[model samples]
Target chain A: MKKILVAAFMVLLGASWANAAGTAAGTQIQNSLTLDYEVGGINQTDINADDGNGFLVDNKNDVLVTTADVASVKVTPGSTAQVLTFTVKNEGNKVQDFILSVSDAGAAFSLTDNFNATSQSIFVESGTTPGYQSGEDTETYIDELAADGEKTVYVVASIPASQVNGDASIITLTAQVATGGTASSQGSATVNDTGADAEDTEQIVWADSAGETDAVEDGKHSDASAYEVQSASLTVTKGSCVIWDPANEGTNPKRIPGAVVRYTIQVANAAGAQDATSVVATDVLPGTVTYGVGGSGLTQIARVVTEVCSCTSPGTANTGNVSESTGTVTATYESPISASETQCAYFDVTIN
Target chain B: MKKGFLSILLIFAFSSIVYADVSIKSQSLQEKIINKQTKWVKATKVIPGTKIRYINTMSNNGTVMAQNLVITNAIPKHMLYVDKSAKCDGVCSITYSVDGKAFDVPAKLFVTENGKKRVAKALEYKAIRWIVQTLDANQSSSVQFDATLE
Candidate 1:
């Protein structure tokens, strides 16, 4: 049967020439020759020859990017969007089209990029779900990208409610090398096929390699990626002391006129910050003092107390999460105070 | 039909007088560096790893001696041959082929892989030959090789 259909069409033409990355940009490469000779006893007829137009195959363009983040992304200063991931890769031989852009100006890893990240877009990773997908990645640039293809890019910024705790920003992303067969637009940039050699036109050979800010062969590349920030820093404080004074009935104690006063307020939170939730702590009784006298409503003390309302082991005092009404004085703490934690909130008054 | 159109015009006038006794040419170059010296030129376009070369020549125009000759070539299909580069000038003999229909000699080719047997590679050749053994009558020779483009 036609040699088993020509050996199954040469195994489907060697599997589409092993998937491609090199021989495709206009591919002509005809080269012929054949000859044969004879004469003494006679037998002449086989010449062939070539060089009749056959050259093409050019375009090596290249593109790389990389930075699918392996660290520094822990952001949270008001956070929104905030992605980073990068990948690009089309180390070209043909099918291209890239053009994406983003830049926090550069440099940042052990951090020092101080702040600047608000609405910084650039998407293109709609692989149907594989990271950055604010509702299915919106596709901002790299369209065709084949030959050794790669694509997974994103940047999506917005972390700025005044940015704190280690601040940082970085970003970068780049990509450039365009012109591959229009399909949604952008295609144009690709430039570096200068003079001579036009054996049938197929030019463009930049070969990319510099990245981090792009340069060598300049078809653009870049990488970087940072962010940092991590919120929650709290601190408060507030001391007060004159514990009991029936006219110095405990030695040096005197705020006079029925003395008794005691109040503390600490709070803390800050050993690398983040984790200060719920904490309340209020206190407004000063019409010459009188809200509960020697402890009555708020006494949760024991955060390693530093002496002001004195409480070495005095934790339980009708702790209904503490509260007093018109003369104020409230304390809440529904848990979270972590990170180098401190939390005091004491209360005791009677002076007028 | 006019005696079959006069035997197709005498077999196209006896194969145009036996194809005027042997000739051939072919070229395709590439090397290029220019002002810093390197120059080879002529290949109008080629990038995926470039190399090229090819050459060919062949002559011998009439009055006798042209024996055995041969030549061939093929290769081009995203290219790749280069190992030992293939040359040919005075005495001739060269050979190779993978499957552009059997040629031989690099200790008789081989190729099978996975099913074992190996030995082919010069990027799996595909065709080259050469032969010669005589040309005389005004003579000419050439034959070159190279390849790479993949």
Candidate 2:
């Protein structure tokens, strides 16, 4: 009876130890079992024996994971080609092969506001362990990335020449792990056989398990940058010409009292990609000069030329007023000056 | 406890005695031409060589009058001071400084030119000061000067 009871107790303890051996993925589960036995008679000494003490075993499974990141960039409109960079890391316990793709965020290419991707494929850096050889690989292939390994990639893009101010473009990069044949397989496989004597090929089968063995999770990252157009460089030039004799017209064209001096103000936009808005030209005649006047002390005025003198069509005429007390003259442009365009204004004052 | 309460009361009384109500406002002006008439227009944007007028208005809003009030303004960079353009309405003394440190009348202000002491040119004036003897409560006064952008 004692021997039977000891055998039953050992079996129960083995079952309990097996139940506590299950553990989370990616970690080893080590366990051991020990047994002690004793035999004795009521009047005699006891004999003891210990076996299977400190005998340990461990088990684990692989896990698959990945992540990606992209860096933002800044460039000016009409600038040369620029680079967009990204980093893809593999956090799984096995090697992974990643394929790359780049696309704009939904807006079709247009002349007013858009960016152009110069290359359809991404290029990986060279000399990286398990990385693709430079210049030989066109597609963004990782070849082999060890566990917790990462690779950097570069994509070239250009800003359209006609891109307007404050224009922006968002570029998304996606990396997907390749899976298929023996070369491209995902997760681990299991096999099961019911017959006692089965063929070697029939005994082994693939089990489609999802976690670490041959498994891969796709990674996606996106970044955007804006093209800032600079302000136009507007230059103003003023020139003065004197008219000494009013009645004689061409007589005495030098500075003199009671002479009328005509002034020309030219405003030009120097930048080819920018335009000037709300442009106005003003000039305050010095204390020595007074506003030209006609009979009965009525003030005289001048008109601004709307178009360039070289143009064949007559330019629009803008009128300017003179202040008798302050000797100020002003002319406001009716339209904004386009890039690389020039506008002029004319006014006249009398020498005090 | 009584001594601490009295200290708090004394601090409040000192703060009230030190506080005074006075305000200063400033603006820039430019001459505008309209229908052959010169009008003073608020200067919003000025270009090189444009003449700008700066007016500073001081007001005493407190119940007690303000005494020995002095107002000073430094000439802005890239600007040339117009000669004899500073003006004030009250019985005040106006002074000019070439270095923004020493102040005196225009005739007395001097600068070392070529190792010789000479009267500073109007364009060399760096700062302006106005000294008012007294300003009655609820009264306001204005000071103005003209400068040309270089």
Per-residue lDDT of candidate 2, residues A1-352 (tens digit): 2121111111112211211112111221111111111112111111221121211111111222221222235555566545555566543323445565566642222223355544344666554443434454344455555434676765556666675544556554555543212443332222222234221111211111232112222122232322234445677877777654345444655566666776777777775636666777768779887766322132343555655532212245654222224566776754567777777776667677
Error of 2 at A63 (Å): 12
Residue runs of model 1 more than 4 Å from their true location after superposition: A1-34, A39-59, A72-100, A103-172, A178-188, A191-228, A233-352, B1-71, B74-78, B81-127, B130-148
DockQ for each numbered candidate: 0.28, 0.00
lDDT (tens digit, per residue) of candidate 1 on B6-91: 99999988776553367878888988888999988888767777898888887778655788778777777778888998998888
Give a tens-digit lDDT track for model 1, residues A142-174.
888888888889888889888888788988889
Taken over the whole model, the C-alpha lDDT of each candidate is: 0.75, 0.51
Which CAPRI quality tier does the interface of model 1 achieve? acceptable
Q: Per-residue lDDT of B19-126 in model 2, one digit per residue for the tens? A: 235566666666767699997666532333457677777676755566555656666544578999999876888888888767799999999989999999999987
Residue pairs clashing, model 2: A62-A212, A180-A184, A186-A214, A187-A213, A187-A214, A187-A215, A189-A207, A190-A207
The true-versus-predicted C-alpha distance at residue A321 of model 1, in Å, is: 24
